[model samples]
Target: MPGVEREPEGAGSARRSLAALLLSMGVSAAFAVAFIVVVGLDPGITFALLAALLVSAASAYRVLFGSPRRAGGITVGRTVMAGALATLVVFGAIQAIPHGRDHTNPPVVSEPAWDSPRTRELAAAACFLCHSNETRWPGYTNVAPVSWALTDHILTARDTFNFSAWEEFPTSARLIEAAIRDGRMPPWNFRLLHPEARLSAAEKEELIAGIRATLGG
Candidate 1:
């Protein structure tokens, strides 16, 4: 019993190190989900980024501790982490920039050219998504980083010509007609999801004429 040997101190250090790494990985994972849920970020992207973070942190730790089993893996992991972090930062900044507008259930300030039923229908179908207070916000709108882009587009569109505040802004009939004629107002991206917004040539002409008559172009 007197000659029994004790395990080396290095073994204890290695065990502690592994425990610390595992704890860190668990914390990072929990935070990642919290970030996605709290901010309403795209879950797929967030999970992918979280995986990258775990891989990178693990690899970096291995490399620093002189584990040469997969040196190249460590390099790749660091690169992925850097790129992902940069992307997240840029998207985060965009989201943080307030456009000084709130998406509220505000009272309708004015009405558009309701001279004809079809005219009203066209406006409701195509222009309401971004230009009116009755925006039917899509599920995707809640998910960033796409949400950031969508919000910015909506704010800009409203600022240029808000149909809800038709009287206050008083947009010209000619401009409205031109926007539809040139396929500009309801941009292509918008039409991708809302096929109803994609007006045919006849429909466009009818809408334009209605706008001209109603708004006195």
Candidate 2:
């Protein structure tokens, strides 16, 4: 009888809590949408709202039921082993791919001048900041959705112009100069974070000179 009497009030309390939670979620979603809009991020407000909801749910769960403390040694060991295995698998797959047909036989420019030390260094200093397999500043680059964008951009840029395989492309010195001068290459947003990649007036002149020298212009 005592338990039965408490059931009705318990149900009412649960309903009230759910209503409050939902209201709070709604307000949080609205705020996220507004913030994303103000920031001018692509994909609009829905992405931000969803991200906020996920974070809120995680926080609520953690608060209601405390998270288990990690056994640091075991966790670190497991992570290191997983990373090593993944690296080996990736390396093996890359090595197994047909290098001749997939790489060597691809359409190439075949200009020795394109592979000159000056040209390679210039590409590394300027283009590789956002378009190479080797990334320099990579702390925030590993974080979730932002990492996704960075990875996609870098991969796409590399596919378009792989500096290591530049001799294969029908690239010309003029094309390179024009791409850099017009601010079409290296991308605007990428330059925002890597200001050193932003070509200075003097550096741009030097780059153009180097390209012209290579092309015998």
Candidate 3:
């Protein structure tokens, strides 16, 4: 016991490298989780991406910094496994939320009966996602965090306008035209994701004319 031999005072290269990996992963994961939580994101979607990111980062680190020995491999594997488990839990929790999985198009009660086929076509192409019963929910909407935000916007938009429920508004044509002219209807943020909603000057004018004629303002 008195003549015990010591290997070294400092950790080995492999141990040091493993420590670095864990430190990096921890920092990155903390930032990501904070961002997701702060934004009120659906953890399911955000965590899945976070898991993938962790795996990718580990792989990149191994490649760049040289592969770890058995201990390091075990460490990485355990971290990845933990990440996967976290993702699954988040996803399950998200599935239990209301309207979380209601990305399907609801039944149309009665769309505004358009007098002009051209106006109908234009509306279908540009405003359908938000202003109609027929919403083409994108693949991304199937995911949680994004789905939540996008679904909220669509619901709010429908509540505001809803060409399908045009009869209720009475002065729908004037309101719609004014909103479009001022570039406030489709909204700039919506247009960024949905380029089709971005109308040209001429297209806007034509759409206004068509709406006026159809609704008889």
- TM-score against truth, every candidate: 0.58, 0.48, 0.57
Against the true structure, whose TM-score is highest?
1
What overall lDDT goes with each candidate model? 0.67, 0.53, 0.68
Model 2 residue runs over 4 Å out of place are: 1-119, 215-217
Tens digit of per-residue lDDT, candidate 3, span 1-217: 5665765433464566586577657866785665464434556766665766566655654554455464444354545554455556655666566764687766676666677788888777778888877888767777765677677777777787677666553346898898888998676666777778888898888888988887778
Write down the TM-score for model 1.
0.58
Model 1: per-residue Cα lDDT over 11-43, one tens digit each = 655555465556666766775766565443457
After best superposition, candidate 1 residue 32: deviation in angstroms?
22
Steric clash count of candidate 3? 0
**lDDT at residue 154 of model 2 (Cα atoms):** 56
- For residues 142-172, write the lDDT of model 2, one tens digit per residue: 4333444455455566566654455543356
